[model samples]
Target: MCRLTRLVACLLTLLFLVSCSSHSTQREAQPGLFLSSNNLPVFMSSPQVSFVLITKIQVPVQEGFDQEARLRNTLAVLTEMAAEVGANAIIVTNAEEFAAAYNRVSTGTHFLAGASFDLSPDAFKHVQLKAQAIYLNR
Candidate 1:
């Protein structure tokens, strides 16, 4: 019947639209100092190889994520940043995790009554990574 045909067309159109949507976290490389296809390696000092420091990179660690996954994500982000600056290698200088605290205050007015509350400070652990982006001449 006509209704069935219209319903099928609508569903097909909806499916097409959904399939065309892009993932929010997908990263696209921009044309920069180096080709994105080039795999960046972690630099290890050697007597024969020479490298030049391109720039330094630092990424704030995210809390509440799996340790391995967080490390992988950090590496990916660092690589992307380094690649943008034409670095062919990276040397991780520091990775440190420390305890941090922050205080939260809530204030509200209820029907002409003003109320203010100070919440106890919350403690959390934060990590930071520092690396040097370098270009190696081999």
Candidate 2:
């Protein structure tokens, strides 16, 4: 009974880590200017080049629990995504961190249901990043 319980505990830990993994989606490429939100207006309003929308990016952040890692990862992911889409710059429209209890035991149909029951804080926190993927006009 003791050995069986230990095995079960290990399996549960593995499952939880797997379920909390991060995910990212990439879009097609284009040529353009790459500008952060702070530098947007200067480059965007310039007559020499125009800002074009390549795609919007949304990704689940993994190191959200750690402040330093979260910040680094956020910037890295955005830069990577922009490069993937051949974007010279990325304008982050919204960046936020949120926590919510999620139900992880449901079937495919109801994968994410609001947590009605009390749950541990560590199990429900998540970070999400949303950005406007843009390219510069040649």
lDDT scores in order? 0.54, 0.53
Name the top lDDT candidate. Answer: 1
Q: Compared with the true structure, what per-residue lDDT tens digits does model 1 show for residues 23-128?
A: 1122222223583724988643322477777777766543334555556666677777788777777777664321121111112111122422432111111244
Error of 1 at 26 (Å): 26
lDDT per residue as tens, model 2, 1-138: 999999999999999998775654456556454444333331212245576777767655435455456555666776676665566666665542222211232112223356444433333234466666667655
CA lDDT, candidate 1, residue 46? 26
Deviation in Å, model 1, residue 59 alpha carbon: 0.7
Provide the lowest-lDDT 10-residue window in model 1. Answer: 101-110
TM-score per model over all chains: 0.50, 0.46
Candidate 2: give its CA RMSD in angstroms: 10.2
Return the TM-score for candidate 2, rounded to 2 decimals.
Answer: 0.46
Error of 1 at 44 (Å): 6.6
lDDT, residue 26, candidate 2: 52
Off by over 4 Å in 1: 1-33, 44-48, 62-64, 96-126
